[model samples]
Target: MIKNIIILFIAFLSVTDLFSQEKPFWNDIQKFKESDRFNPPVQKAIVFIGSSSFAMWHDVQDYFPGYTIINRSFGGSTLPDVTGYLNDIVFPYHPKQVVIYCGDNDLANSDTITANEVLQRFKLLFQKIRKQLPSISIVYVSIKPSPSRKHLMTKAAQANIMIQKYLKTQKNTSFVDVYHKMLNKNGSIRSDIFLQDELHMNAKGYAIWKQAILPYLKK
Candidate 1:
């Protein structure tokens, strides 16, 4: 009976591992890398990696023209997607800094993952990046609080707290708190900052982001 139980445990572990494999976001990564939106080869680059926020920020170069900035953003990508391809998409560029924005898609997609879990994945991704490129700096952009996703506001705030705390201990990691800046007097997202759907940002939103990020990029 003990031997039979051991065999069954092994079978169960295999099944669990199979179910744990993440859904593919590689197709979008592949397409983005091939598209005109991706930055060309550069020396001492600064990479921006994330979801639609990063993708939609079209004026990154205009904001930080002094450094070679590569925008490797794909719309609707979650943390797991960016974590999977960090080596190929980010490390090869030998960037001085990487600005990351993710997690909104994870919450929006009904993943039901806890705030700590999202923080853990961010830690894992940072570890992977460090293993390949030890000297590179990591700048984590706070997952902005959206009025449209007000139902998940608690989740977003909790995740930001975890991320902020995590950033404090790391050597070259920093948190960019765009959430507080985006809020209006009533604590809703500033409607003037976002586009039509109130999900993504407009030029004014990008301008605020540019001002917040310029100091770090100059460093």
Candidate 2:
């Protein structure tokens, strides 16, 4: 009986460890908070919140020069990680609009999350933001179709469609479809618009993003 109980306890611990590993973002939040660039003094700012795409885009302020813009991105992060630190990075500033581009990392890292799960997390995040700052507009940038992550395009499209549909029913939420703009005639990512790695955007890519967002910025 003693040996059987010991084996069952070890099995329980193994299951717990597996579950913990599945939530990869849980371990990265502290590092994200420490390295976050958008510190404060961000009253009425247009904050860009997301993973490496936002972090690596070096010309965001120049692209949207009129508004008080803040880039609160950390590379190698996902929506779960952003959700963990939303209050500190997002709500304290009371932003006028939040432009988000997350979930690529979640798709890349996690094996079990379905398109539905990704959409559910987005809905949860929107609710959290609404509760904290009721009047703020939440703008979700559609996950760009990357040549490197082409296999995950179907999942990405499904997630984007769900989010766009949900945003239609909300008061201050909008979906920015950069995915459609980034595609070439063959429905693949435009190689000319991306870096050599085919994962990140080049200067031309940022220009396209800027043009899409120009109309929305307040004078």
Candidate 3:
């Protein structure tokens, strides 16, 4: 009986470890929360939230001069991750507007994640924000194309289409077509837009984003 009890305890710990690994980004969210406790963001500002794409936009304020924008992105985050920590990042700021760039990470995180699944997840997120921040102006930047993740581009493109269609039916929601814009004239991912990793965007890519996204932001 003693040996059986010990084995069960070890098994429980293993399961707990696996659970923790599944949500590794939780700690990153907590850190951001703790930071806010000290130097909180300006209320009613524009929040750029999502995965590494927004997290690494180190010069975002420079890109959008004279805008009250706060960057709360944690790298490798997914749509679910953003929704999971919305209380910390989104709700806390009392944002007047929001721009999101996610979904690619969800598709890249697993092979089984479908375009429809991503679309549904995004719809869920949209509904949640609407229920809470009814007057908020929200923009969804389409999943970008990448040289390294080109194999998944088709699904990402499909997800973008679904999201676009859905957003059209909603009020005060805009879909920035960054996906199509990121492609070259030949309909291929622009090699110059990405960094050395061939995954994340470079300054040129962000420039494209700035042009596409700026017009839609609340003035």
- lDDT tens readout by residue for model 2, 60-134: 888776677878777888787788778766876788888888888778787778888888888888888888888
Compared with the true structure, the alpha-carbon lDDT of candidate 3 equals: 0.90
Question: Which window of ten consecutive residues has the lowest lDDT sum in model 3?
Answer: 23-32
Q: How accurate is candidate 1 locally (lDDT)?
A: 0.81
Residue-level lDDT of model 1, residues 107-205, one tens digit each, is 888857888888887888888887887877889888987767777778888999999998898888888888888988888778888888878988899
lDDT (tens digit, per residue) of candidate 3 on 1-219? 999999999999898778767876866776787888898778999999999989999899899988988898989988988888788788988999989999989999999999999999998888888888998999999998899999999999999999999999999999999888988788998898899999998899899999999999886
1 or 3, which is superior by TM-score? 3
Weakest ten-residue segment in model 2 by summed lDDT:
24-33
Off by over 4 Å in 3: 1-22
Question: How would the candidate models be sorted by TM-score, starting from the highest?
Answer: 3, 1, 2
What lDDT does each candidate get? 0.81, 0.81, 0.90
| Residue pairs in collision within model 1 | none
Which is superior by lDDT, 1 or 3?
A: 3
